[model samples]
Target: MSTSWRIRIMLTIHAKLVEAMLAQAHKDHPFEICGVIAGPEKSNLPLRLIPMRNAAQSETFFKFDPQEQLQVWREMEARGEEPIVIYHSHTHTPAYPSRTDVQYASQPQSHYVIVPTDPAYGEEIRSFRILDGMVTEERIRMINSYKAEWELSMEAMVA
Candidate 1:
């Protein structure tokens, strides 16, 4: 039994969305922001990202808006995409999950990607899979420079 895990992610997005997210994150200096990533699921990959509309308030914490998320999920389904991961940024903290994070993380199968923007570690990103209060570090595989991948094969192996 180990604590390490990996999440395979595929990224293909409009450049504007990414820039907007980064800019927004940089602007909101001390609050954690969140968004969604959507894409098609290949043999072993899934598409996911944080949504901009929900990221405006990051200091308090984040909770997915069911209606908005459902819309994205439905949109993905219509476009043959799958919601594979959930991403959020930690304002001035590490990417590690907080106690609240553990309690609030309700998704059992989706990978959680955390972006830590501490001054000491700008743009530090990491992923984890939280289940039953167990948090494990998950490796991120970049499918390409513009596209990243996270494969949960390690978790599967452990399970």
Candidate 2:
């Protein structure tokens, strides 16, 4: 097994909202769902929980709204957060990145958090760094001074 590395990620978490998102996702069942993760960053590290919005439902995948996302990034920069990462969940799959996932990633510096909500491994969360189609898991460590989301960010549980 590969040991994890701690990423000094600046986290932006909303207490009630994150819980609500997870609950809604758990209720959706089977089909994959998606959402947006926004926050502030310092030296490229994230530090705030701006907001998470639902992705449009699709047949085999969930697609995020690029325009809206850009708007969010712009707003984050306006407030000093900037686009640090993009997060989503895997309804019935492992937390590892799939080939399809590798082909679609656009943010090389940002962390990719995958939530495996499989009934057998529902509590497992995983984090990764995908760059130029190569994927490597990154360890997520909770900082003593930081506040975690009421639930998890798909990254925290796996770490």
Candidate 3:
């Protein structure tokens, strides 16, 4: 496997996970929510949800609770997993990344998922690959199950 990340211009994630994240975002309402969907390290698959507390607790921004983040990261490491998707909600803002988000993005390989609690957009969830300050929007193929998604990906790889 290549040590360097292979960035995808598009991705497929479970609609269930998307629904869960959107619910979390709505629950957090005016406050931004954040989390990670982790999978086997280097799998390029986001297989589970790990909703995180926004330490900032601001409507306009989000910051992971330092302790929670530390614990989560360690747990994923122990499970031989890495964050395949790093996600956050934007309350009262567009689903696009903010200037600060662009500056703070540290995961070039992980899909940066955004859930906007803007009722105007009906809480549409979007994904992007944010690398070196450049944010490239990605296609999100919502699937019913991760297994189905994984099998398709494997077939694509084989083809």
- Local accuracy of candidate 2 as per-residue lDDT tens digits, 67-135: 767777678778766555556667766768878778888877677766666767566556687889888
Error of 2 at 57 (Å): 0.8
User: Residue-wise lDDT of candidate 1 within 22-86, one digit each (tens)?
Assistant: 66666765677776665555323443444645434557576666687778777877888665557
The alpha-carbon lDDT assigned to residue 99 of candidate 3 equals 96
lDDT of 3 by residue, 1-159 (tens): 322222255777887889999899989888999999998776677888999999999999999898999999999999999999999998887899999999989988799999988888566788888888898998888877677556655655555
lDDT of each: 0.61, 0.57, 0.85
Worst 10 residues of 2 by lDDT: 1-10
Q: List the residue pairs that clash in candidate 2.
A: 10-46, 10-47, 12-48, 12-49, 13-49, 40-81, 125-158
Best candidate per TM-score, number?
3
Residue 59, model 2, lDDT = 27
lDDT (Cα) of model 1: 0.61
Model 1 stretches astray by more than 4 angstroms: 1-24, 42-50, 145-159
Extract clashing residue pairs from model 3. Answer: none
Q: Which has the better lDDT: candidate 2, or candidate 3?
A: 3
